[model samples]
Target chain A: MEAIIPVIITSVCVYGLFRRINIFDSFVEGVKEGFGTVRFVAPTMIALLVAVGTLRASGFLDFIAELISPLAESVGFPAELVPMGLLRPVSGSGATALLTGIYRDCGPDSFAGRCASVVAGSTETTFYAVTMYYGAAGIKKIRHTLFSALLADLTAIIVSVITVGLLMS
Target chain B: MSYIFGVMIALGFIYALVSGNMAALSAGIPEAAASAVELLISISGMLCMWSGFMRIAKDCGLTEKLARLLAPLLRRLYPDIDPDSKAFGYISVNISANLLGLGNAATPPGLNAMRELRKRSGTEIASDSMITFVVMNTASIQLVPATVAALRKSYGSTQPFDIIICVWITSAVALAVGLMSSRLISALTRRGRIWKR
Candidate 1:
């Protein structure tokens, strides 16, 4: 797994050499463009992080998770993972924090911990993805992307719990 | 974006007032800003390196070659796009990078692809292909989630990779559901004039 990146870099460099391209110069050019990309996304990132952070700190996320906990438990999902699932799509850092908390409270090898790991691994931060991608194009009307992405996230969360239960036990 | 943030902030403020959690919310605002900067610092290096490599790849025609290899699938996903265009090339490589678990590397190509798509459509609203591409990305289609495995190992899991199969199952299911729903909703809304910009 670690070797994949080195392998890709080497292959790309070798191919660049074969094509007689100025690899270093081309790389520098791309890096400069990357700086612009970062600048472009800075506002979106800051705004999203602040909103998510405030919601998380104010306990609204836990509130929503608690509100949905019964429905989740009725469906066989663990209560502890409900918050993680709710935050998974909206905030990557918040979800990771919850995952770590789960690891501390329930040992990492426990059902809840394993389920959290699988859920985190399987789900993308859909809010971030949608915002960054569409924001880049200056597209305001995202239509159904958010709905579909959240639906996918829900599927992943449910499937992760079920799969972990099936395999772990 | 505006609606999401507006509602979120409103909820946070109201909840804080109701629960007397105003201190935490007040402190969290600046902390979130700092964390956002930290996040950017962490990812900026990979973003630069990958973007640089991508530039080299484009210069050497590797992206074009890769695009050609994935032409069949790309054609199906983005039927309106010409396979030889720059947008097609970026989209193909972006998906490839995401599948390989190169999350940071995928963003440059993704952003570039969005630019190209927007330019082609000449509109501020997202086109069908744009939504499909973003949805595909948001499905978390990685083959091996290295970060999760490493975190598990750090937490003393002897078999960190054991969940790989489960991860694969969940992600694949998510991707399938997301794509299907995206297509379904798009079709349903196409005739109704319901999805106003």
Candidate 2:
């Protein structure tokens, strides 16, 4: 992976230069654009982060975990996979943070961490990504995009979690 | 906005406490934060690649080449829009980006594409081209699942490639459904026009 990083960077630089684009300038421009995106997405993302934080602090997530635990168990989802299901939709980073904690608590090779890993690998950031991108673009007619993407996200989570859980168990 | 999220999160946390799972609540904080950082990094890398690739593609006349290559399909899918129109180009790029599983990367292009489409249509309501584009963009075929792969790597997975089948299946189904729905709606509207006359 480390080896791949330099190769990617070099390829991008070559691609940029080949187009008569100054690599430094393009890098600077890209970074600037990235920061702009951060600012543009800040209000939404910060709100999402805070909501996630408060949920954690208030223990709503655990209640969800507990409530969903039985159904999850029936479907072969481990108990630890609960937080992951909730986190998967809202924020990818949030989900990863949960996965890390599971890794720490259950150890890396444990069934719980593996389930979390599979869930993490299976799902995409559904609502947040769609909202941010569409909102930024000033697209009012998001139409059926949201519903469709969410469906995909749900499918990924269910299939990935169940398959991994069954295999591991 | 943050306040609303804060309230919601807090409410969730309170609910968890009431449910008697302090540990799960405790673990959620860092999870959210780390996940946020990881998402940002992934988005940055993807956007950078897209920005650079788009620039190169445009410079090399690849956009035109792609447009020509996709013109027949676009004509069939978006008969309402002129094949030679700028919106056609933007739509192609947006679709291409989505096909690569770079949906976030597709946003800028999608925005540009929509802007172009709107300019061509000159209407407030969705035009046929715009609707078709939306369907295609929404149903985008994802060849790679970058974010998922990254998360898998972070979680210490040895076989992160395991998700390739799932991605292929889900995205393929989504694309098919989206295309069918858009085509069905368009056909119905065309019939409605004849009925009204």
Candidate 3:
């Protein structure tokens, strides 16, 4: 299944040549456009990247993590995982680090670690995708992208909680 | 986002001063920028490769085939987009690749699809289709969270895909709800209804 993308690309190339399309020319055209887009979005991406890094490093994420465990302490999830759920959408690497850290600290079979695993898998970097796509697409008015993405992330979090409750218990 | 960046930096600075991790905070700024650059460099390759394939696919009417397949669902979602446009092809690729948990490959096609949607939009403001496309891409319901599978494997899980049902259900719910919210908001906010042809 992982090979599907490569297979798709190769077949497209072969099909392009079979159709007598200048595959090289079209490839170059696409590359040029991609380069232009990268240049255009670099600043916005940088802004997001830097913000994500600082948000993680500044202990703010830790603070949020601390705040979450008490709210639902009855379920008995570890406080260590709250950061993983919150940060997954803001930053992937941060969440991965958090996931591994939680696994190491709490043991992968622990309820907290299981919750982290499910939560991490269930969500995407909603804001990051939103930022990159909007920047690349050059749509100034972002409209409901952020709201919708966050709502999805929230849903992912809620569903993760439920899944863990069902499977881990 | 700029405001968020500023706030983050300011918070970082204040936290560093209060916590005496100023050196670490200062050091992390440049490192973050560098990593962001590295990310773009790698993503640029993915973007170029998939965009080129999309071009090839478009030339061969493969996208039209995809469009035909997804039209019933997407047509109502993207009323502004022409039925025959190549955007549908890329959109289909984006949707499928994401569902299969091909995150990296899903992106270039996603970017391609968004670019096409943006072209159709033609205004600074996002159109309904563009907004919906972004929402779908953002919450591209994966059947398998491949990254999570790898993580589970490394942690010595007997079965890595145990989370598959969970991810599938969660993402499906997220996608459905997100698209509706985005569409509803877009409609509510549509005052001028400008589509530059």
lDDT of 1 by residue, B1-197 (tens): 57867987899999999999999999977886786677566556656766687678778877557656777987898888888799988999898777655566689999999999999888888899998999998888776565566556656677766787788899989888988899888888885676574
Could you tell me how far off, in angstroms, the CA of residue B11 lies in candidate 2 after the best superposition? 2.3
Task: Residues A26-76, candidate 3: write the lDDT tens digits.
Answer: 878766765776687677666666765675566655566668768767665
Q: What lDDT would each prediction earn against the true structure?
A: 0.80, 0.58, 0.69
In terms of DockQ, which candidate is strongest? 1
Candidate 2 docking: what grade? acceptable
lDDT of 1 by residue, A106-159 (tens): 767888888888888888888888989998899988888898888999999889
In model 1, which runs have C-alpha deviations exceeding 4 angstroms? Answer: A1-71, B1-69, B193-197
For candidate 3, the docking band is acceptable
- Candidate 3 residue B17 Cα shift, in angstroms, is 13
True-contact fraction per candidate equals: 0.79, 0.24, 0.65
Model 3's number of clashes is 0
Candidate 2 structure quality by residue, lDDT tens digits, A1-169: 3344345456656765776765665555545654565566645554466456656555555566678888867857677776667667766545655665565457545666655655554455666555554554466765555554555555555555555554545
